[model samples]
Target: MAESKIPIYGAIGANVAIAVTKFIVAGITGSSAMLSEGIHSAVDTFNGVLLLVGLHLSKRPATAEHPFGHGKELYFWSLIVAVLIFGLGGGVSFYEGIQHIRQPEPMRDPTWNYVVLAAAALFEGTSFLIALRQFRGQARGVPFWEALDRSKDPTTYTVLAEDSAALAGLAVAALGIYFSHALNMPMLDGVASVVIGVLLAGVAVLLIAQSRGLLIGEGVRPETAKAIRAVVMEQPSVEGVGRVLSMYVGPDEVLVVVDVDFKDDTPTGDAADAIAAIEKQVRARFPMIRRIFVEASDAPGGDASAARPGAAS
Candidate 1:
């Protein structure tokens, strides 16, 4: 959790500074793209605040009402962030672009636009590098796309995606400003704003999907499930391992319920011992597994059908 905050803090600081500069420049230059960029930075600043709030809320202790703790608070807030990005960031930018197109404004000297953009790029780039480094450390050498697909935490990736989009939007704004000034076609500025909106929308949609999955209780990776099963099978008193049900209750916390078949002749006391051993081994192997429930069955073949309806043999 401490690590997650590093990138978010960096992003918030950078976006706040950039947003103010962008709004000032947009006011001075009357460039549609610059205005849109200002909105984008402002939206990003707000999103960063929301993410921080979510992170803090998610640290609350578990209560009877929420046995799994408040981890999903982060997911819920992340989803809200995505929605805001779509509505406020993307929707507003696109609308502003269309309005500018319908009533084009005369182009002004773009010197300030270029200056602000260059400075924004520098700050945004620095923030992006910080986020990328954090994400890479978390990925632990996993390929980029694959790691992103498997990531349970939203903060690092969300910042990464936002920064990446921001960089791209800056490029488009630069081009639009250049072309509008060079060709004396102010409508081109509006086109650039529209493109930035579309880009933001695309990124928001992806974030929404990812956050939705986590909120709905996504499970561990297949390889992790397989490894857990292997650990149970290694126990001498165990006959078989049944369904290895698991869910990520928090970024670094997992709840697992495994169906274990102890040898039919094993006494209840020995079975209990084996269950304890199983829990210890699993926790030792995977510290992220915070809570584990072993459903032990003494039946031959370790069948758990009686204990869990629809449980596989």
Candidate 2:
């Protein structure tokens, strides 16, 4: 989690610089596309700060109010970033575009706009590469898209999406400024602003949808669950593995509950020892699983009912 935060810090620095330049150019040139890009960068800067706060909050130890720690705080903030992207960034861009369409203004110093945009694109591309590298590490041997879909971390994906959109917006803005000047149709610049807003809204929707699942208690990856089952079955004192339930409570924290049918003739003392051994082995095998519950029964079909709530680790 700490290592994953570098991208967010990088983004904050890059976006703050880019946004200041963008706003200055937008004011000087009166380019709708440039104004839209400024809004995008400003919102991204704020979102980076929010991610940092969320990361810090999520790392807080479990408290009386939050027995599982503040892990979901990150998800909550991620959701807020999505809403801000759609509301403040996308909505304002769309409104500005429509106003510009109704009342076009002759741009001043178009060359400066080009220079600033080029620089902004360079910065944004670097940030995108950083996020892409981390994402690729998580992707491993699997398909990139599939890995992203299954990723448990929200900060990396948000930064990646923002930077990718930033680069695309720069391209669109450049084209809009160029064509609007050459063809003497300033409405195209307004159209470009509208496109940027639509793009942001779409990205926001994607983030919101993905984060919603995670906030609502998404389970561990398929492989993690399978490995857990394997671990439980490998125990000598266990006759059969019943059910294994798992969920992610934090970025790197997992909660696992397992039910096992022990050997029928095992004594009470031996069963207690077996439970202790299983817990130790499971924790050693999967260090991320901080909270674990193991239930023993006489029959494989014995209803473990549901896991009893225990103190979070």
Candidate 3:
């Protein structure tokens, strides 16, 4: 099944609106924490743009050079977006926040900052809900952090993480603003800004790590591996499955490669026919499995080390 881009587009709109409001409020109130949060949201908006572009390009049909399709391109561009958020957005905010901490400015007009933070939180929360709704089945069996790790849908993860962190940062900023104003301490606002920056940086690092694995072509999970193996072994002529390898080629698709052993008496043509039938069966059964290659061998459970990349006969 092809992944939908609706949630990501909605996230982008939310980020734009939140970023504008936060920046304007930060400027009006001169709150370092609010400013840092604003910067984070701005970067999130830009990242959304990158994700949308990647999603569009990744949908293209296979070409000669990339016969498997351009699905992994999503990971590459998402990684680029993560790096920019880490360095440009998170890093810059952290540095500025530190500087503000050193020369603290009195927190002025806490009320307006908190109100804006509340509004931003509401917007980000809505975006997060949309992303979660879209990812319902995809993240079902996985833990939260592990889901992010195993997910091939970069845009969805990005939206979820950015919105969640935005909400948390708003809370932190609100606390900092309140304390600094209530206690008449100028340094607290800067400290809150620094905390928000660190949080953003941490989230960016996580996104980078997840995207990097996809770019390098990580294998499918144990459950998926078992399913592919079972499907391949069900063929009549096939004695057993040797090694089954599958990788996420897109958000909702995988490329499956399997090595199968045939009966000793199996003729070359018979083996070929069996292989074709297994491939067709597997594809028909699993919509998420987009491509398959099956190779026949006489040896039972062919040598693990001898497994070639494609369907070998």
- Candidate 1 residue lDDT tens string, 214-262: 8887988899999999998988888888899988888888888888887
> On residues 1-313, what C-alpha lDDT tens digit does candidate 3 reach at each position?
2355767787788889888988888888888888888888888888888888888888898899988888888888889888878887778788878888898887667788878888888888888888888777678777777776666788788888877888888898889888988998878888887888788889889988888777777777888778777876776776787777778887777887787777766666666666667766666766677777665556334332322333311
Q: Count clashes in each candidate, considering only residues at least 3 apart in sequence or on different chains.
A: 0, 0, 0
RMSD in angstroms between candidate 3 and the native structure over all alpha carbons: 3.8
List TM-score per model, in order: 0.93, 0.88, 0.88
* Evaluation by lDDT, superior candidate among 1 and 3: 1
Q: What are the runs in model 1 whose C-alpha is more than 4 Å off?
A: 299-313
Error of 3 at 142 (Å): 7.5
Model 1: residue 209 alpha-carbon error in angstroms: 0.3
Off by more than 4 A, model 3 = 1-3, 137-150, 299-313
Predictions ranked by lDDT, top down?
Answer: 1, 2, 3
Which lDDT tens digits does candidate 2 get at residues 1-313? 7678988988998999999999998999989999999999999999999999999888898779887788888999999999999987889988989998999987766999999999999999989988888889877787988888877788899999899889988999999999999988999999999988998999999999988888898887778778877876776777987778887887778888877787766666666666666677777877778888877657333433423333344
